[model samples]
Target: MGMIVPSLAHWLEASELLNGKGMFMTGTDTNVGKTWVGKQLIHTLRVLGREVIPRKPVESGWNADIQQTDAWQLANAAGLELDNSICPYRFSAAISPPRAAHLVGKHLTLQTLAATCPTRWDKRQFLYVEGAGGFYSPIADDGLNADLAQILGLPVVLVAENKLGCINHVLLAAEAIQQRRVPFAGVILNNRQSLPESMDNLNDLRAYLTVPVVTFPAT
Candidate 1:
């Protein structure tokens, strides 16, 4: 069939956009393992001999250790050299960037983040932009991570953790994707086995959703 609707979200309009450029990655909610799944995809893509650049547009809860965060893991996973530029905004609190920055005495701005996109990552490299928190998650004082994804113009892959009541959460996110008109790149049913009726739920999702979904099994 044609591209699954979810796969279409955050998708590059021009293959030329990501022929060797980058992809933007986002998630459903906080601590949903965006980094874990992103690390594997970056590593796998890198092994296939493509240049992959992973970035967290906004990150919070940094420990002053480069190797500790998700961005670092993606850098290492893709076998690329690490640098602070990979993730632009680092917040101290373990909360949303807007709230976290408030606790740290600074305002996080979308303009600051939008400025980082023009830099050349690699000629044929993949740029994977990871967002902090879910679609509706607060980014700036007035915006959320979904806004960040919209600014990037890259199709987005949403990692929907399959915990209890995920159908509501994931479907709500899908609606937001549609409402925003951001490229919809399908959902990764993270922790596929966690839900008691995961298979049943997934079938329900597939039946109603216009996008294609893939549930990742454990390694």
Candidate 2:
């Protein structure tokens, strides 16, 4: 299916991008559980009576056992079909998005990605966008996650794995997001693994950053 039409009002309200209950999920690093936390977020929102459409604009690491890509997992989480509307681009190589796209002789651009977004937002209550790699990881040849996030102009929800050295990564990512003047929507600390430094790292992040920090227990 092609891009769904997004709400014009949402596109115009640049200042209040996240103000309308939509969010863009980014991460401190790859394998940081961005999708793990995002999946739970979708479930929680659904229980709260909000119709959420999750978007993982670009993803790598194909899991053929389940189907093809991470989009399949996310689609299942959202209870939607594995359609291009949800993930505009999907690559098979377990590498950075730009390199993955290069292998297939196709180039990913911010314009093409931004254009893939739902053209008209009608009944959908929320648009939850997920980014590939880390905040500064190269998503396209010319753009990074920061660039895409800016183009989409949604409140940033930073997902970080609760582990040793996460404090530094999370803080650095937060700094980068703020530097770009993106709307900050707080952080989610995902306990994808049990580590002794988890609580200390979590506490440090909460103390260091002013944005709200929520925890996701290991599951």
Candidate 3:
């Protein structure tokens, strides 16, 4: 049978780009499958005999009853326990993390968030960090996700929901990342919904983007 998701080759390329350090995963927008792609990447790295450490640092829209916050899911993907070390700032409001932090009389800073990520890297160990929303979305009281990406200095993997207008979103985000001079690993177009085969969003993106443009649920 054909591969149902991204091929091993794609993951291998990603691994090489990461060079055993890890990647900062962001999305073009919320619900663009950043967590989903991060989980898959973690799994693929494990299959390649690499240790994966996943971090969600800060998450909004957290509900203890839900038990499925982004941080929880990321820790689960890495086979680690849910703890403050993995995610230190979690708010109940379903808004930008900085706004959510404000709702509870908390203030977050880019430095504080960046400090949560692991600095030490061992051979065959990967550290995966997922941002709260889009690349430019506000993540701290003082910075956007782009700012945090600059601080961490890890290569970025942008995930965009595949559908109408994704080309614009992907390109705009790519330009922003380029402006920041962050190492852009690639773009992952997640198929959250089926599109007409004639749409060919993948090729359209590849035509414009110089970086690798891969599709989830590999078309």
Candidate 4:
């Protein structure tokens, strides 16, 4: 599909509809710091006195002892207690949400995934919905991460790991996002490792994509 970049007016309209309180965070690839960046954003928003509700629609590779799941980490970051609203589907296996659901004898549908999210708008609390794995990663039997993001109708914050081949990944993710006509906020480059090409990739991405590209230092 041909990429179609939306005008500023489109984003403005979405912001108005959402009451300027919702966004989707998706990564270029797995372990690309989507949760880490999300945690930082939640912390920053909380510091600014905004009540933030973090959601990871589906999570895999659950750890019982540490409660170490993407959704748990995000919920903790927002200073909110854990609940189904934060993460609807969770699996112990380390795999994609759809596959994990399949292994558990449960079918994943886009409708079910959408229904698990917060449908009502709350003026006081901002919503940060994080997607599992990469932007194109499958979350349901028929839908990908981008589809879930589209269904939520929230602006997206694309996260990419700062490393080799990151430029291609970020650009590809951005292209898919553009083609979907999703309200894109911008991109965040997470420096997971210090590499010689880190700064170069950051600059190349800034020059390649029209959207604003920001960096997240190692934590």
Per TM-score, the best of the predicted structures is 3
lDDT of 4 at 85: 86
- In order of appearance, the predictions have TM-scores of 0.82, 0.85, 0.93, 0.87
Per-residue lDDT for 17-73 in model 3, tens only? 535488899999988889887877777677666788888889999978645788887
Instruction: Please identify which of the two predictions, 2 or 3, would achieve the higher lDDT against the true structure.
Output: 3
State the weakest 10-residue window (summed lDDT) of model 4: 1-10
Give the poorly placed runs of model 4, Cα more than 4 Å off: 1-19, 197-199
TM-score (C-alpha) between model 1 and the true structure:
0.82
Q: In candidate 3, which residue ranges exceed 4 Å CA deviation? A: 1-11
Worst 10 residues of 3 by lDDT: 1-10
Candidate lDDT scores, in order, read 0.70, 0.75, 0.84, 0.78
Using TM-score as the yardstick, the better of models 1 and 2 is 2
Give the candidate number with the greatest lDDT.
3
Per-residue accuracy of model 4 over 1-219 as CA lDDT, tens digit each: 122223322322433422477788899888888888778777666654568888887888877854567788888888878898888788888898889888989888888888877787668788888888888998899999999998999888898987788888888889999999998777878876778743577678878977777667622
List, in order, the clash count of every candidate structure.
20, 7, 0, 0
| Candidate number that wins on lDDT, 1 or 3 | 3
Candidate 2 accuracy as TM-score: 0.85
Output the TM-score of candidate 3.
Answer: 0.93
The positional error of residue 50 in candidate 1, measured at the CA in angstroms, is 2.0
